[model samples]
Target: MAQIAFILLCHKDPEAIISQARQLTAAGDYMAIHFDARANPADFQRIQDALNDNPNVTFAKKRIKCGWGEWSLVQASLNAVEAALDAFPRATHFYMLSGDCMAIKSAEYAHALLDGEDVDYIESFDFFESDWIKTGFKEERLIYRHYLNERKHKKLFYASFRLQERLGLKRDIPSDIQVMIGSQWWCLRRRTVEWVMDFCRERKDVMRFFRSTWIPDETFFQTIVRHVVPDTEICTSTLTFLMFTDYGMPVTFYNDHYDLLLSQDFLFARKISPEATELKQRLGELYAAKGIEFQISNEGRSLFRFLTSRGRNGVRFAPRFWEAESSLGRERELLIVVAKKWHVAKRLASKIQEVTNIQAIEYLFDEASCPMPDLGGIQTQMGKRARHRRALMRMLYEYYDTDRMVICMDPKNMEMFQDFFTDRSITRLLEVESVFTDDYLAGHAIRVGLAGENTPSQSMERLLPTIRADVLGESDRIRDAGFERYYRISELRDAQDNAFALSQFLTIPQDEALQIAQTNHLFDD
Candidate 1:
């Protein structure tokens, strides 16, 4: 049977770790615990007892304290991996997951996933940006000082090492190699695991390099494997949710976003936060009602699927909503744009005005609120923000209310303002209605071409030119204002309007578009 090995670096969160172990064990996956060296023996004993008699559970080596900029953490994780491989020699694929990562896919599906692919699961790490290299340190004192100054004391003990600053070693640092970030957790085939272990065991220089590096957990296995197997299939993104709240921090899954993990694909979700127990229970109910399950495929591969749900089939777009207007019916209007101080929203607004002949007002919220908490004084904050939103939303509707055709760049603050406006007439802006991500306005447009409802007979391709023009026009002004470069707005616009265009932009197919849109909530549910 294919198996997932849940590994945990123990700390203050014993309850969290044990709970996760229980969940994974219940789901018929293997569990392994590597208690941090600093943890009291009593605590480890408690963990052992909690995980007792679980056929899949294994207590691995005691872990040494590891610092952020050091390699000890990597060594500890590698130890757990070694133990898991030895204990479950029969498991075809070895899954390395964290105690924090709940299992969301069924055991059968996870097994199937392991059985399906022929390649090693992790991605190439050598292409990461060079900036990540600066994080590694070798000296205990310098490492301590850096962490102390950075207020990251929790990671101090394990990382600080005497060999970090060896000058000869510094000369040996590979310039061609780049550091990449990944889940401290991942899965791999048995052969790949054995290969990685053997490679590390034989390379003395590689062992030396691991001693002084920062975030060695990220680079150790990933970089080592890249040298031998140049084309492994790394799970650089989530297999489930796009984003999730973990311990109150928002983790997103996007360009190089590997932190937002999923517990499973079909039935369960990782606990968003320890505080969200109620929410998690509610989520479980939601999953049960949906009839998702894991089973062996006809090909005898373990795979998870949903019986109640089928994928969607269209281009889905998410738009940012406008902020709420305090002066919904106010007569006098203001059109102040708000954004980061350096964002240059004012210049963009000016260019839009130049093209459309509409006057724009600009405000720097950062400057307005400066000396902010530092200056204890009058409280006009709420009033100031409300004033800006009310003024801008009011002006946005002015042309619409009067039946005038016009376009204006929202003050950067209004970047999220599209969803809040209530007027149905305001929905005519094809861009806003189709692409908003805010909760204020009517939810995302579901302009499916139902036979009876208003549907476009012209394929999404036919409408692409107009959409491209509008987006390109807007982005040009934004770029002229000194914003960073991206794909030409024309390219992005077509990707946004037509599903087929999006498939081209992403280089995926039409069927994939529906899957992406549904999974990402890019279209209305």
Candidate 2:
């Protein structure tokens, strides 16, 4: 078995840290602890005393007064790594972790997984290409030098920084180095760790540049490692499960997150708090029941057996959809646009509001010939025939706060879409008729719909083919996509004719329909 070293950064809760160290302790393993210099010396001594009997446990001599979003945190981790390698010459791999982290997998499983791989498991993304830079706040953290500890003059400091940036006085990163960012926690081979340290030592300017950058701890190691290590030798996952709040802060894991944690294929989970003592105890019991031992004699043999057995079962647990659903809170209204003839739009809207009890609005593509009375729960909007349908969609989204919308060719098709609004339905359709604009937009909104009981897996099997029939002539493409599960409901099939009927009734020229369909990319493959 390859000797593994864990470099853990701890600042609080000595008891929890000790428990974590004990759980991970085994032969051919080393645990190096780095207590933050700001933490009480008495507490640090208590941790050291508790682990004094274990020869594998050691503490770093250089402790850093670490602060969030600061370089000191990186310094502390580097110190722990140095100590681990110096203390355990036999160590082959090193894992960086925080005190709040707990191992979800057994040490044997971890060793087996790592031993089979010769790559560094660190999540890294090019800074310029990352969504945080592309879609989120851009260059806010990079352009200005950050002093994380200067809280007293924060507003004035930022104001001055902004002034400097507006004047084109931005800080420049080294031309030789490319900035990369990732999760602070990572597991890497000893060689990669040594290379990163050496790179930082040789490039003092790069180190100095990162010291003033915001959240440098996330970028410093990843940038150095990605630059030094070959791309083939890097695995783009940190192998750590972290639950973050909407604001991007790691939330404390409690009893409620137990199933969520278990569903992930990660070895460790972080930010578990003292309040989660009961949860930790329960998890320990579950691990014991699963027969995951702390140590194994044959290297990689037990892990290979466990993995093969699991593969034979062919069952993978997906995170409960309700977890994401609950986070989204309330379900948004679905906007349906229907044909203007025979008051079909109003009737369909009223029926949907009555049956599903969901807030829905109907938009008439053509100007209403007469004043339509509001049907209490259902709302109506009329658009000029010359106006593009996408304009109406934008107006609905802007004025009504409608989160999801669908355009229908006819009102008779409304019954066929009732399942779309049903709580038991998947809410989003992977494939829909090309005429249906906002398919992706609606899918995103509904993907995080309100939380309740989960829909049965068979419900998706029944829903897709029924909707497929109404989608014109894409049957071959749909079937080839493996969506042909033969759920024949006559109501769904009959609705397919409504599009043609409404075309005739509205006297909509064939040329106009063809043009609209072409513009919407609704043509069958």
Deviation of model 1 at 228, angstroms: 2.9
Task: Indicate the worst ten consecutive residues by lDDT in candidate 2.
Answer: 483-492
RMSD of 2: 16.1
Identify the candidate with maximal TM-score. 2
- For 1-525, candidate 1 gives per-residue lDDT tens digits of 566665555565677677667666665567667777776778777888887877788877656775554576777778887878777666566655543444444565556666676666653444344332333343332122222212365455334332334432233455544444444445667777788889778877667765655556766777766666546355443232323232334342221111112222322233245555544444333322333443211210011111111122122354324333244452332232322212234443444344444444344233454222211222247454443543434444453453322222333322323332343332212121133222211111112111111212232223244334443444344445442111121212443444443243234467654343323322222
- Candidate 1 global TM-score: 0.49
Alpha carbon lDDT of residue 352, candidate 1?
35
Positional deviation of residue 133's Cα in model 2 after best superposition, in angstroms:
4.8
List where candidate 1 sits over 4 angstroms from the true fold.
127-169, 174-181, 238-271, 279-525
TM-score of 2: 0.58
